[model samples]
Target chain A: MKLVISIAGDNLQSPFDARFGRAAAFCLVDSDTGAWTAHANPALEAAGGAGVQAAQFVAGLGARAVVSGAYGPKAYASLSAAGIAMHLAPGNAPRTAADVLAQFQAGALNQAQAATQDGRH
Target chain B: MRIVVASGKGGTGKTTVATSLALVGGESVRCLDCDVEAPNAALFLHPVLDRRQEVGIPLPRVDTALCTHCGKCAEVCQYHAIAVLGQTTLVFPELCHGCGSCTRLCPEAAITEHLHVTGVLEGGLTADGLEFARGLLQVGEPMAVPVIRELKRWPPLRRPALEIWDAPPGASCPVVETLRGADFALLVTEPTPFGLHDLKQVVGIARALEIPAGVVVNRDGIGDQGVDAYCADQGLPILLRIPMERRIAEGLARGRSLLETAPDYRPAFQALLAAIQDRVNTEYAP
Candidate 1:
């Protein structure tokens, strides 16, 4: 299973990006091998519908679950359709991607059943 | 020629100018208040709005019984208006652009379309004999272009010698729709910083659409010459200037035209019209 985490930098130590659709980058981790890679979010500057596009990109990457600080209604809907569980990163924010991944692996993070906030109109 | 009276900033007197022009031009003019979201030129023009036509957009509807849930419709929608989850498909009409791509691309032939009323187009005749029309967008309707389009076409005849379009304030999609096929953009502005900033934005839109524009400086004595200097630098003529006077505003508050407030400006407006005709003749002649 692969896990995708919205992030701010290319490394595991980078802060988790709270914004799902317009996040600067996404950190994808191989659950079995503990190997990971970062991809710059192509939907960061999208004119509109960034949330749905990002959700599609994450699903295309074969991510079984996603970790992020927040999820928008559209992103939540799309990810749910793709059968990917969404996990919120623990702490106020700026929590490292590795910390979020560890908490998820440790079963500390909770799965989100709905969107945390509204998105752009 | 169709002349659009636009103000990049709000409260710069687009309606005042447009309504006055319509009143002055009388039988030869067709006045279209295209600011559908807040159609207020009627307040001053007092057109007897008797004709009403509801405007709507085509929205997609899925026939679940025929749908195979292949997710092809979801994949084809650029706005994510449709989503397929498991064996169920969801359609979000608010996000749909009504391109009919989902209906045409669906291999299962499950998608259909239905009309959704978004606004109404109203037509009437002013007491002064000019044809008047306006669009009223339904509250909370995100789209205004359809209403404006319907209003523009509701007149039944484009044979009027001139069409004065009272456009909405701003350089957004609604403004673009209003300016689309206009022969000239009679831009109204106040000589203020905010007015100057927004004027530049609208100017860019007009230039992009290849429409000629002129400036009308309202509330002239209240602010600096930023707008004047900008216009001078850009070679745009300042056609008319209404002084910042309380009496003129008081007359407007009472729903009176500029000609009603002070008849002295009647000749000025006429001269302004003549100048526009001369410019259009020499520069815009086909």
Candidate 2:
């Protein structure tokens, strides 16, 4: 199963975007088989129609699960509806990526939830 | 006179220096904290807001009830902010750059553009006669330009007012938006290697923007001599050197504005103000 993960604060996942300027993205390897690709959550710069294109870009990448720090309500819903799994990474970077993929493979990952869990945003 | 106090790197004491300058400049000045995200200047100045304005960005609102999924809106969007897949259309608010290309390109007129509030611009007066202003980006919103733009458009400070802009770090949109059209940019920096690295980044940005820039070395005793040397080599004047004093850190830790404690530092800020005024006058002399 393909996966999508949000690396920075679970805002959104962008595998192809080089946004945020200095964030890093890498493919997580499990059993020496690369199982996931993660990238930084650069601030999004699209408005209106461009927004849809961004969502489409992520959806088409065959991401089944997204392990991110956080996700907005709209994005959570759209990705969830598309059957993309969402995992909340407690921390960020290479460690977060490893932990998330491990949790998913163990079938212990919870269903993706909206950002309002923190009563913020 | 508009004075933008900025640093290319975050946590380099930009807010600290800006707040001190405002306090020293007396009440005839306005201080605008353009660092929308993580604005800490208010923690020191702590002004009561007297005015507030909603800052928003235009996003396309697609009428789902309209027939057809032509995907024309997505095709014209240069930033890829919108997309239509099969019978469904998806919108990523954070990715939207607020350009109206989609609504304009829609042949069926199904897409109507609307404004979405991303942040708030606030203005008020501190008890010490200093005017305070800042923009608060709604958590999760990515765009800082609209808020910064609105903050700048706020009524020009009653003239002759020394405007201190506490700008966001880095050379990105937020930083550019804050520095745009400023008369002078005061680059706040530390004496560390990281500070020197980011300072060069900001200096390049300032040169690109064609703005006259200077440096204010915070924590002068620590770090190395690279900052001073760089300024001399680049012909960028060193505007102020804030010696790394324990009392300064202590006062900040206790939430007391630096000027409130070390009143002697007031003269330094005043002198720096005078020097800046003189330099600007000389440079812009007719």
Best candidate per lDDT, number?
1
How many Å off is the CA of A72 in candidate 1? 2.0
Which number leads on TM-score? 1
Candidate 2: regions farther than 4 A off: A1-121, B156-160
The DockQ of each candidate is 0.33, 0.23
| Poorest 10 consecutive residues by lDDT, candidate 2 chain B | B77-86
- Give the alpha carbon lDDT tens digit for every residue of B64-148 in model 1: 8999988898788888778776566777666776788998999988988898789998888878877888899999778888888
lDDT of 2 by residue, A71-121 (tens): 555555555556656665544244544555666667765664564332112
DockQ of 2: 0.23
- Top DockQ prediction, candidate number: 1
Please report the interface RMSD of model 2 to 1 decimal: 4.6
True contacts kept of each: 0.22, 0.44
